[model samples]
Target: MLRASLLASVAATPFFITAATAQDYFDIGEIIVSGGLSPIEANAFGRASNVITAQEIERRGLTTVQDALRALPGVSVNGSSNSFTQVRIRGGESGHTLILIDGVEAAGGDGEYVLSGLQTANIERIEVLRGPQSVYYGSNASTGVINIITRKGAIGDTYTATLEVGAATTATAFVSRRTERGGVALSFSHLDDRGYDQSGDGGEKDGLERTTINLSGDYLLTDDWKVGFTLRGSDEEADTDPSPFGATDADSYVVDDPDEFSTRDERTASIYTEYEMMGGRLTHRLSFNKTKYKSTYSSGLPVTRESEAVKYRLSYGLDGRTVADTDHLLSLLVENKKDSSDDNPLYAREATSVALEYRGSFANGLDVQAGARFDDNTVFEDATTWNVGLSYQIPDTGVRLHASAGVGVVNPSYFELYADAYGYSGNPNLTPERNESFDIGAEFAILDGRGSFDVTYFNETLIDEITDVATGPGAFSFVNQAGKSDRQGVEVSGNIQATDALNLRLAYTYLDAKNPDGSVEIRRPRHELALGATLDTFGGRGSVSGDIRHVSGNYDSQFWQWPAPTVELPSYTTVNVAAQYELSDTITLNGRITNLFDDDAVDAWGFASRGRAAYVGISAKF
Candidate 1:
């Protein structure tokens, strides 16, 4: 299995490698940073994790991060449009997952990051760590973490560019440069889609126009010091439909209104410095991150809403070998964050946190990890979280066992605490939600490392869940629930190098999510399955890959109906195929077809999904 190969490689490397330098080789997926304070090998990690390498993204012709994540186990992605995509994991709410870019928080004041705005240009790799992770990442990490790592400077100068045209009148241009000491990347994408009638009837097209820009660079100050920065911005104008606020017919809520449109602008930036000390035994890092969001709605009162978030963090790590064939790492972190919005000038929240983590690896094929964190908040009750895990490889047997348990916390979002819109009131007395979770998994290597299979079972319970309650006619307020919500699931995956020229992969998930009253949760499918195959053609100079995903047994609510009626959504299946051929040493030709069969399956009752579409593109390296 690949995990065995990764472990063997890590066992041969040095005790510690600075995080800044590790980025140079992130494509290997041998070291993972999001799972712990310090980088750890995949074999030693006790978490259910998945990685999407840059090569895979390019091979699949994925333009957005959300597209790359759609087929991953335990992950579900859906949206009404390109500007409102949401990602959920393991039956957890979208806000329960933390989004990170180069160790910087990418979420807004609402504690959620819309995945549609994140492009794949200049991305080195993506890491998904499943389970409660508040002990390592603080709030908004009640279920998992998605860490997006960008490409770093290489040994020499290099330049690359790509141009593509696709369905929906989409056009994209990307360019990047890498130097010995530093590197920079830039990308721009524009989309003008003549969307379908979202109401499932003939009507005006709900079109949309969106533009995105991403920039990043880093420079080495010295042999042991480095500085880097990233900037991302996006603008979107989307035609929306009228709600059922005052409509006489409940089913007319999804009808399109040409005059009802919304505009949004989002920006995020981060700067950081890293310095190694004590001859590489100790490392220190300092970073500052900021995100801003602005939106205007033309449906009701031409209302404008704006929010901003700022975070400052500092951390130190010490690495050493205390015993023969053993390694130990200890880390400490301190951070301060503030979230505010112009809608409520007097409503802002600040939080300070301190955390400690320890990781140990021994020659007896056992790895252990533990972490704890304490958070101080100004608006809600304080929280403390802890986690522990271990992984062991049975010697002489091709089996590995892993298990982890953790406590997670999520503070109420600013909107939930201060918003006074559409007859909904905020609840300042609401407390943070708490979660307890555990998972156990085992992996088996078969066919002499040519094939691998794994299965895991996870269980979680959430307490003090924030929910809306009706107070009076057309009035509601947020409040903590009295009972706990339960979630349990099983995940299975397999990989096989079937032949020297072909590879196959499969993943399936079975989930059971329940509300406090033991009722089925909405939007979480009970069964999801994905199958993929890749073939190397032209004697390794060209490649072709195809993927299929199926989702079934999902339910959603019709919010426009009084007392919101729970409805089951129809199952969906999507197919995508991509191929790339190397024209020369510096040029490549590529293309892809999405939704090959044009199955018009809607994730939501009133939302219409895209049909079969094809794209062609060219890329060059110099």
Candidate 2:
């Protein structure tokens, strides 16, 4: 299976590498981005950070944010297809990374992280900061923060559009418009394919459709203060056979029809007000948001579920540049969530949280930040989280030393605390999981920040962990285990711009995870490596790019190994490539190939990955 996935990825590379591209040069580094600070500033001050700008997205020919993150170090991303992607940072679980779109939290009632609602088409840039960030972000940010900043209207009225066709019969269309007053964007994407099978017959196949619409508007309200609104909606559908391992007959194995599997719909609305004063030194913001998520499973009983969430926040900031540049921020938030399941035990949950944060840069090129959060959940008594971090730059050289420590809590999700799905029951007595993490790191920039290296060593300890261990009656329930789970790891990643024509990015991560029960956590890899580069030629008119990703074998469980002693998911590597051509000032063309090596990596117990694929696309501006 691994061989097939690799082979497929390799085979598709030629198409992307052979096309001619235009020299229209743009530097993402120059784009004005503010999640309080620019990406460069954030990277320099934060303990660990990764920035992916819109230009980078286009340069890499990435269709989704998940694909863009896969090449980064210490970030683990997995998906059955484009629509079911999930990401984990370091060794933390997927749900532990908080995803924010335009400063509003995107969470489902089931506590599932909702990255699916973000359309790459509408994003201006993304900042992925690693380590326990609950102090600044609150709650789910125990491991990291993925903040997606949406595009804003600055340039005069203009329109951007793109259409793509690829292997799997994949098709995507995107249209975006920007005016001095407001901006809007829309995208429609679908992928369908006959999959490759490892057992000679009955391989795996899937079909998916995703549609996204986004609207954003800003009225200057006298130049110093402005109020803005962001509204986004998306719907997705998928049909595929359950892993072929579940099929006993070859005919029953092929997903008979591509559109018979599952459906999901999600919508989000947010409004924000911003006022600037004292020469842009003081800023205040208030925001309100509502999100609704619905998912229906074709193969399950009860068949459907819906989750709704409403959240509001107020934030104030003050900037000063006296002795040392400094900023003080305060935020308060309230969240209410309700879920209706065909099986209603996991019915509803409400939570209210508050946080205060302060950060500043000193004259000696030292930066410090700290914050605390207090949360009260109707389910749990109370939980408090806090963190403090510092980064200092050494004199005369572009080297920086960083360190941080934090403690947090993850209140059990609805599924763990009160699910009645299928035949399983939830435990109302579940306690909030307590987590403590610490890290120390350093970064060195050579050749004027064009080439940089960063490394971090980190550790986390979880107490009173919750796990759904088998109890009795053919059901699983969440239990507060007595022992602690500890994980430690090292992450190293770098990018070197050897010359104007060549750029290279490399990353490697090693993890050590274990518990008192002697079981390794599920789906955690011990080692991962990634290498990517872009070569530009034809006077900046043509380019060639490719990436290689590798993951080490991992165990599935602590026990249950008999016939082959813990079936090992073998290590595998996949490659991707893209080429571009400038059709005119308003148009460009691109060709891409994925799984060029045709590696068919298996997932879970029954499903295998898709093989080699090819695609062609065009983008135009008006």
RMSD of each: 4.0, 8.5
Q: Report the lDDT tens digits of candidate 1 across residue range 556-592.
A: 8877666777787889899999999999998999889
Q: How do all models score by TM-score?
A: 0.90, 0.84
- lDDT of model 1, residue 576: 91
lDDT of 2 by residue, 467-533 (tens): 8777677777788889988888999989999898999999998988777576676567788889999
True lDDT of residue 559, candidate 2: 29
TM-score of 1: 0.90
Highest lDDT: which candidate? 1
Best by TM-score: 1
User: What number of clashing residue pairs does each candidate have, in the order they appear?
Assistant: 0, 33
